[model samples]
Target: MTRTILTEAGAQTAPSGDALWLSAADALRITGWELKPEGMCRGELCVPLPAGMAKDGQIDLAAFWGHIGAPLAHDAGGTVWSLGTAASERRQSLETLEAPDFTLPDLAGAAHSLSDLRGKKTLLVTWASW
Candidate 1:
């Protein structure tokens, strides 16, 4: 049976499997990463993966994601998913003492990215109701 998976790329349809096995096409559409002979390639970036991760033309999403030292979480029923930044990228940001970039909507619902304010002194005040 096929189910709707909620990922960072939004909802995607995938068949049931032991791993989050998705077709090469679906993998690229959902994750923007493609399994190439040189490993997973996204544009000029490619990360080498282990052998046999792709079987019958499908790749294991969870395995590929974890291999890059990123975080992924799912509900108990596996219907929802969340992807987080990779450790390597986070480490790089920490090394540079730069704040992580993120996007948020302004008062007029205009979306803005922290990177848009790059090279400017910006103060970020956040609030959350626990």
Candidate 2:
């Protein structure tokens, strides 16, 4: 599933199994934190950001954002930024509770239910091409 948060600045989209990147406006809109050419801010508080923001309005995101304290890096393209892994202090996985049963349609339009595998050990893994 895809999760998104719409803020006054813009829409921040974070797909499952993928990291999140927020523009200066996006970060301010969602978290009420503004990214100056210097770093992040919310009135008097200013965080000395990292070396992500070049001459342009881009940011390389410092190693602190919410509970996932990881930095966001930009490649040579400068178009796409990669949000690195959560801090070592975080859990290996963020899922802390079991989910409710849901059904998904197969390629052939057959419905598959999680409950169907109740008696077996089920491992669900996810990935993206990036």
Candidate 3:
């Protein structure tokens, strides 16, 4: 869950406080991942970004967020970007995916498909609060 940070031509990280500001477009270009005025691009996929760029030429933060179904948070100073949550649920690649399967027990104490609990042991555990 690492994020890319963009800076001026060769900005340095501050030793005691927040880093210097990066215009959104510059940040995106350098990282090769950005929510730009045209859209969000990674490798080759482009989602039609729905808002205009800011007066200063950065992508409009709020509109880009809305387009991606992601949430935004800003510090007291209003420096903001998508919280990076939207794509958190996405798969980085299809390298490891197994089919879904499961099983459960019935009140009669008989195990059912959960597929009939085939090739597996069905444990019946119950709990109650009185």
Q: What TM-score would every model get versus the actual structure?
A: 0.72, 0.34, 0.39
How do these models rank on lDDT, best leading? Answer: 1, 2, 3
- Candidates in order: C-alpha RMSD to true structure: 2.9, 10.7, 13.4
Best by lDDT: 1
Taken over the whole model, the C-alpha lDDT of each candidate is 0.79, 0.52, 0.46
Model 1 agreement with the true structure over 15-67: per-residue lDDT tens digits: 77665778888888878899888888999999987987777879888888888
TM-score, structure 1 vs. true: 0.72
Please list the residue runs of candidate 3 whose C-alpha ends up more than 4 Å from where it truly belongs after superposition. 1-24, 29-32, 35-38, 51-56, 80-82, 91-130
Give the top-scoring candidate (TM-score).
Answer: 1
Compose the digit string of candidate 2's lDDT tens values, residues 67-122: 23654554454443444444552353435445445677777999898889887888
Error of 1 at 7 (Å): 5.0
Total clashes for model 2: 1
TM-score of 2: 0.34
lDDT of 3 at 81: 27
